[model samples]
Target: MTSLAAPAATYAEAKDVARRLVEARLAARPLAGIPGPLPDTLDQAYQIQDAAIALWPDEIAGWKVGRVPAAPGEEASSERLAGPIFRRQVRQATPGETPFPVLVGGFAAVEAEFVIRLGADAPAGKVDWSLDEAAALVAAWHIGVETAGSPMAEINAIGGVAVAGDFGNNAGVILGPEVPGWRERPLDSMACEVTIDGRRIGTGTAASIPGGPLESLVFLLGHCAGRGLPLRAGALVATGAATGVHDIVSGQSSVVSFGALGAIACRAEPARPFALGTLAP
Candidate 1:
């Protein structure tokens, strides 16, 4: 039988793979595949993620985390995956921010999530922080929408490893008001619903997110440190979607309700090309 061995890994190889995806994202073009084989492991996938972030000139606005679903009959993993959110793409909508721009001809989805804004840095180089320690770093939490998109339409077809390779399939974040007494609330018990153009699409809770938000933050803090991407103070970390991911298209409006927390509404418009420097402050 012929040998079936994978090629050795290198940062250069990883960066090259990331470069193609980055270019496609910037130009709003779809990508077929990485130049070579896709990253096979989570570590390799994160390497590509870091490389891709380096290629982008925009400032890091925040990070988004998502659960990696376990296989059938297997216990769920405590670990979570992350992606960077560029500053230019972060939006603050009070009660009526309408017509958000979602890229047409791309992998686009919306997720209703609880977002945490960090008050203290969970400095890099430490790997054993507890959930309470991580929660202490949070300054505030908000109900928000995570605009998930990618240049690779087939990204999810390959699994979480591939999604992690491309900025966790994150494109932007739509921030809402801060949640009062968020710490006192039972996040896992809170329910969230997602709708598009007045039609209900999905409903879920923090329990749907592996380990809940605080645990997800703990996982992110350690994961980022291990991957050399530190969790900085003032960064917004949108925890995994409370409501399941729902498909969206340009020209449609989306509304996400988090029960007593409140609702966020935004319409999607076709993406228009613009200079990153102009958008970045």
Candidate 2:
């Protein structure tokens, strides 16, 4: 586990980190290290993330969920972590390769995912959800790719606390076609292979995500509600990665094949800096 050596950060420190991260993101540059002291707890990490969310100008499109491993000397805060996905960053996949922007010198990867789109708003006051209950809210499921990236190069090396603080280490999502009747199929039966630059890198089924993707959605239901950011209709949730996260770079291309169902192809382009108040790609 990555140790959180610094004491819990104060709100001022959290805001400072958030400001630096947001600036770096807008500039499409990399940070040599975390902007400030690493958070000592998950709650502290969320505080920083919340500050960044407030500073960012985009509207939330949905959320992304990732696993949170137990720390060396502490029980895991939760099995999964959540991050906001901005509306402008969400792009629908075309038949040809979609362009995914990756920040040079920053962390970038492709994760095969089973994405869920909500048909209706979640009850704002409901803070607890069961797997079955969470399934009911799902309008449909799809095969997708999570474009995971961050301005902090060592984002993952520092562990989940750092990940949560930096928008759950997410950049955008590439939504593929709908997988009809997904609820009736077993996740283990739906396998996928991920290739980067024409080389096979990872292969797995949704079962790779503990209890499958719905469990990840279940966690987010409670998580967002607790934060008072209840999920709304049409929100997309990129459940935990199905295939392992595979590193990629600018100019690289990736194809995720969900055997028979379909495949998604995308190419990585260097992320460009934009002036504040303008839309982010």
Candidate 3:
């Protein structure tokens, strides 16, 4: 088992790093090295993540789950990581609504995702949740796009620990229409395709997400419980990308189709400028 205890010195350093990136926004550059010391384990990484969340001063609108490729000889069951998505950055769009704004130079990318909106609170302290129990918490599901961005440009290259340290590289989310009676749908077998500017960019299914969406929720439930993060009612949880991540630029249009389940389309625009006081918890 991994140790959950992280040094106090390291925690403070991680918090400062997150504060600088949050304040810098699109202007923040990738660090050549994390100050104090780099986190060497998932527990340490999440410690940095929790500290960073405290510094952001915004209500968490949702969370984005991403699979961390398992290390050689590591079990597949232990390969998921999560990050927060602030409420100010979450947006909802219909098939032909206005485009979503995302940071242009700030590690912008798009991912086709399966998103669940929780109906009941999954309070902290309970860590053992079955896939069915996790699924029962979902109020609805949607075909959506996660606007992936990070203040640090080299976050992806730095690995999952770094990714977790900076809100899991999430910038924004575009929610499409809810899939009514989603409980009856066969999510794992559903096909999804992403197209940008009318050209196909990627294709995949829920099967690509480790253990599928419900199981991913189970992992997240346990993770947040362990970290003392509350999973409140109405919070949106986006399962990992189905179609692979695709680079996107400001002013580009994207369309994600989840076969007969539904489709969502939106264009991306340059992020608006904001002062530090704009974000609040």
Best by lDDT: 2
lDDT of 2 by residue, 1-281 (tens): 44445777899999988988898999998988788888988899999999999989899999999987454577544478899999989988889999989999999999999999999899998998998889989999999999999997777778888899999999999999998789889888999999998899999998988889999988899999999999999999999888877889999999999998899999999999877753332
For all predicted structures, in order, the TM-scores are 0.89, 0.93, 0.86
Global lDDT scores for all candidate models = 0.79, 0.89, 0.76
- Which residues of candidate 1, in runs, are more than 4 Å off? 1-9, 69-79, 276-281
User: What TM-score should be assigned to candidate 1?
Assistant: 0.89
Candidate 3, residues 1-281: lDDT per residue as tens digits? 22223354366676665666666563433333344455777677777778777777578988999877344476544478899989987888664844776665566778999898999999679899998889888898887889887755556665677677778878878887787777776766677999999999899997788678888788889988887876889989899889887887888888888888778887888777565453332
Model 3 global lDDT (CA atoms, 0 to 1): 0.76
Q: Report clashes for each candidate as comma-separated counts.
A: 1, 0, 2
Q: 278 in model 3: Cα distance from truth in Å?
A: 11
Ranking by lDDT: 2, 1, 3
RMSD of 2: 3.2
Kindly indicate the candidate among 1 and 3 with the higher TM-score: 1
Q: The CA-based lDDT of model 1 is what?
A: 0.79
Question: What does candidate 3 score on TM?
Answer: 0.86
Give the range of the ten consecutive residues with the poorest summed lDDT in model 2: 69-78
